[model samples]
Target: MRIALLTEGVHPYAQRAGGGWCRRLVEGLAEHEFQLHLLAGDGGGSGGGGGAGEGPATYGPATYELAMWGRRPAGRGPAAHRRRAYVRAYRELVRALVLPGERGSFASGLYRLAELTRQDGALPAFLASGHAQRVLEREWRAPGADTAAGQPLVRDVLVAGDLLEQCLRPLSAPWYGPGPGRLGAVDLCHVVGGGPAALPALVAKRLHGVPFVVTEHGLHLREQYRSYRSAPYRWPVRALLLSFFRLLTEETYREAAVLTPGSAYDQQWQQRCGADPARTRVVHEGTEAVGREAAGVEPEQPVLVWAGALEPGRDADLMLHAYARVRAELPGARLLVYGEESAPGYLDHCKAIAERLELGEGVRFAGLPESTAQAWAAGTVVVFTGLTQRSPRLLADAMLSGRAVISTEVGVAREVVGPSGLLVPPRDPAALAGACLALLRDEERRARFGLAGRLRAQERFAVAPVVTAFREIYLELVSHWPAFPAVDGADGGVPRPFARPAEYWVAGAMAEAH
Candidate 1:
């Protein structure tokens, strides 16, 4: 398939755990030809609105850069009138979302920008603006809301609408190409997630006749709102900013040809936002294989561990709060955190909570490791209370390496953890503390849960199966497109999936090979 792999900022530049899944899709679907269009947050910077859509992308034996975001340019560039027009339109649309009463002008402005972009070569000047950040702020503080909806209705809708217009620079991006130095041609519009990456896809579907498929790893826009809650912006401003995403998600559900949430829980939320049940698929994120003998790994002590980015939403703070309580019952208990940090102050916030609880010595800040499963195998019990409503589950291999997982019943925790693990509600440290204490007290049960989780990860979320499934999707998409483009020798037409004889791996022998 000449797939236009639409992404926000993960590709071209390396982001720790962010680009893994998209890379998997690109590599696994080797049978299908793909045209990559990576995007990065303008971060309101001065970078090219478009990138060269060269030839076939190169992939190493294991990793490929998933172009998610475009890099910001170093200096200020010239602004174009065409770009300014789009900014106005987008801002107005955002104002409409946050403050519905501004509909008349916002609607009028949005269509005008869309109409302009539909013209031949009209995207460049608009996508070249440096005012995106300003636009974002402008709309957050913009106008009228329904008093009863309990959402946001700040100062003036027109001002906010203008701000959104400036921020909607990507709509003017030349990358959404009908030519070279553009997004290129593709059989399907495959969006990696629904935040910044999916935003471009939404526009492409609206402006072009492209068919879009959405596969959400997590709820991107929701996480953004949660992170911004404590920002310097007024509460009313935060409330208003949320309307931007609620509306973005709504658009995603409507335009996407198919919606695939990484977990069933994500699927449910997509439904709430108006996704058709038949179009939504629950495809779990699979783990890259690490060659290690996992059939037998000994858990020596009563330890609790959590693995994931140290972000606000990971619920790391809640885990720290719970650990303080757990240690009262078992003074020797330890909580180890192994993952990179995210968000400006989230890591420090978690550490502060640990210090305040006086549970300093009982915790382990084991830093992120290359092999998440190896890190997970070190624990006797895994304490997973991070917010599940939006965060994607940890690599299935890590979860399966077993430590009794105690997660909030969000996303696919119930399905992933199944009966072998304990479940808890989010934000409840007391319940989390109790679950950790139970697993810490029982060594044999921990061993069983770990093995069961390992087996399940192998059976359900392993890399091979994910590759197989995606290869199929690629073939289906490619079959519909006549041929690949001429750039860099990409032979289009039907890039066949299952084109070669399959190689099978028997159980125990597999981990050793990985």
Candidate 2:
């Protein structure tokens, strides 16, 4: 089956994002043909890097590449003929987004915009127009608008308008309609990331009757809330931005044929964001097993290792405080932090915290280790202090390395660690310190937990099972897709035989029984 893999800033291109998992999926499902539909972004802010627009970064020969939407083009503004309809559609879209409980309007307006774009390819200029700002301002002041209670300023309106335009820019892309490298020919539209990345798939399903699938490694809505929480904007601007994202997320969830979350935590978030429980499935991400030789190796100095990207959410300060408490008890104990700095000055901030705590040599920032296996071998116990995570790769590596873990109670850490390691509440230095001390003080328990962890990683977290699960899901979705109106004289442009529904067999069976 041919699948159109949709991603926004995450796969086949971005180095630091969830591209690794996406690359794994593509490589694992080698039997099926993949058409890459990338929603590229400007390489700025956290987790940002080179996108498809920076020229093609190789993802091997099996993938067919399509258009990438990154930087907006400089154009002569919206055409005169399309202005009226564009204004009307744009107004309704902003109204539905700003007002409370207007999903119907939101969906209609979204599709209307998609249709307009599909027909004329003139959405970008219209979205960036002065008329768009006027529509947004009018909608903000509309009666009974909950978000408008804040009485937004002109600056707020302008910023919100620009932000909305960026979010909706995918509609202006030329790849939505019929023909090769477009959404029309794919058997299934599987969106690897959510939010704007899923926009094309939504349009494809609406325009071509194609089945849509969403796999969220991270909760897009939750991440948006975190990102916009401290955004240097007024409450109304933040509200507008967040509300738009929420509406988009809900639409994506409601329309998806299936929702595959990387962890149960992510699944719960999706359900809370209006995903149907029956349609949601938990497909845990898998990793390769590191060598068992690293297990039970006693280092000269008792060391605790924390590895992964140094981000604010990782709560490195909490790690330091806990390590300080540990040092109070065991002065010789050392905490080795190994990972790349995700944000500028975050590493320095962590270092300052360490200095303030007077954990000079007791805490060390080892940066990215040359060999992951060697790094795992250097630690007596692996630690994860991140306040939020969805199937963190470092935790999986730690388990596979056969090291006992002490991770905060967030995301799927408990589920990932199970009985093999100790769990503590997040942001509690005392609790984290206690948990770390428990594993550190007991050699027998550490050895036993290490063995169990290795077994669990091999049994449950291996890459083979994840690949098999997705392969099955792909086949099932394609095989059971309902028949729809043909495009270009082809049956919904899906692979033959499976494009048609199984109603005939069911009817025949019932008739025979009667």
Highest TM-score, which number?
2
lDDT per residue, candidate 1, 1-514, as tens digits? Answer: 3466666653222222345676677677766665555455443122343544232334222111222233322333323655666567656665565557664454355556656665543433333344544564455544554323343333433333333433354555555544432333445667776654565566655544456677777666556655665555445444554565566677668777777787877777778878899877777777655234563455565777788888876888888888888888889878889888877887788888888889867887878776766777677776666675444446355655655567877667777778767888899989888888877787788777777776777677777777786666655544443332423323344343322212322333686888
Off by over 4 Å in 1: 10-18, 42-49, 53-95, 98-111, 118-166, 176-184, 199-203, 206-208, 231-241, 290-292, 307-371, 387-389, 395-397, 425-434, 474-514
lDDT tens per residue, model 2, 1-514: 6677877763222222556667777789998877666655553321122122322344432233322334454555557877899899988898887778665699889989999877777787787788888999998978877673588889988888777777887776656555656677667888877888888888989888888889887777777777676578898888887788889999999999999988887888888889999998888777655334555457988899988789888888888999999999999999999989987899999999999999988988999899777788889998888887665566777877887888898888887888888889999999999988998999899899988887877776677788899898988887677764445654444454445566756787999999
lDDT value for model 2: 0.78
TM-score for candidate 1, please give it: 0.70
Q: Which candidate number would show the highest lDDT if scored against the true structure?
A: 2
lDDT of 1: 0.60
Model 2 CA deviation exceeding 4 Å by range? 10-16, 42-58, 61-71, 74-81, 146-150, 230-232, 289-296, 308-312, 339-360, 488-497, 501-514
Minimal lDDT window, size 10, model 2 = 45-54
lDDT (Cα atoms) of all candidates against the true structure: 0.60, 0.78
Local lDDT at 463 for model 2:
75
TM-score of 2: 0.86
**TM-score per candidate:** 0.70, 0.86
